[model samples]
Target: MEQNDGLWQALDAMAGEATEYFQKARLLQERMAGITGTAVTDDGYIKVTWRDGGIDGLEINPRAMRMGSADLAETILRLSHEARADSRRQSDAVMSDLFGTQNPAGIVADKEGLQESIDMMRDVFTGAIGDSKDLIDRLQRRLRQD
Candidate 1:
């Protein structure tokens, strides 16, 4: 029937949209995988690169040898933290570019929102099940009276 044909057409269009969205997501993921962030100490004695949530590369200038071991270690740690912050900023940019929002990662990271969603779903299911149970009990009582 014509109505059936229209329904099929609508379903096909929805499927095509879903496929396009998934393809874009895949491409964005690939691009994000290639992203890297780098930072260097103020004196340029230490450089660090962060990728995929970990340190990918580190370089120490020969001038760094003039410093004591403790100083050198402290500098390295500071540079590493800077590099990690840079990486997080870059990742946020990528997420914004792909999703047209800057808070997708924040939303995913938000335990409050996640917990609220879970609680809402649980409440809905519990209410539905309770209603079904009440209906079943009434049906059983009516059948017994019959």
Candidate 2:
């Protein structure tokens, strides 16, 4: 019989790499959860904190009430959007630093670009995992034969 071409070792290495990536992903998620995207008005009367996909805290100064209910509501809404955007930027920066990947919004030019990137990755990983499975099966068959 010929040599095995180190297939088993290669598989082991892939597994180790996958484990390391998952660990890093977990760490990133944990850090993201602790992040609070904050926004405040120019006068520092109104403040907003965004977390876990929504506004978590809002502070309105008594003086802000002088703007009337309508203006105050509009300011709050504006601050919420700003806070959310700030949160996304922070998360994207951290993810890019760790993974060498830009946030989809930053990298994509087309309207559907983010989804397209995701689809491409899904296809590539699916094909790779399928090919790896086939190789493993073939190796197992050869082992049984031997």
Candidate 3:
């Protein structure tokens, strides 16, 4: 009976820890969704905003038209790249806040880390189940001896 109680306590504690991790993950998702990144050309003729990993807004100053079409296209493309980079930086910041580590690869790598944590928890639960089975077997043996 004492062993069963201890096993239940351990399982409850693990469940609580898993719940906390899931809550933190959800909060991080909300924060990342709200993040936006903006960039402007060096000459301030082109501006772009990135959200959810794509260009969400753009602004081209009237002065930008004075440049040759090729130059204007190049500037816009460069600004777009810069905006995407800015978005990556923002995502990394959010990931760092959630995971205590910063990497530019963004959420893909973090998902792997999250999976690993879940795997660890699964192992813990598996071990707990094995321990419970062993305890039950021991108790049955004692009962048989009596």
All models: lDDT? 0.78, 0.82, 0.82
TM-score of 2: 0.69
Greater TM-score among 1 and 3 belongs to: 3
Number of clashes in model 2? 0
Error of 3 at 131 (Å): 1.8
Q: Tell me the tens digit of each residue's lDDT in model 3 across 1-146.
A: 78678888987887896797788788888998888888898788789998987889999889889999999888778788888898888887887877764332543568888777679879977888798889989989999999
Off by over 4 Å in 2: 1-3, 102-146
Model 3 spans with C-alpha error above 4 angstroms? 1-6, 101-122, 135-146
User: Which one is best on TM-score?
Assistant: 3
lDDT of 1: 0.78
What are the models' TM-scores?
A: 0.63, 0.69, 0.73
Please report, as a residue range, the 10-residue window in candidate 2 with the lowest summed lDDT: 1-10
Number of colliding residue pairs in each model: 0, 0, 0
Please write out the lDDT profile of model 2 over residues 46-79, one tens digit for every residue. 9999999999999988999899888899999999
Output the worst ten-in-a-row residue range by lDDT, candidate 1. Answer: 1-10
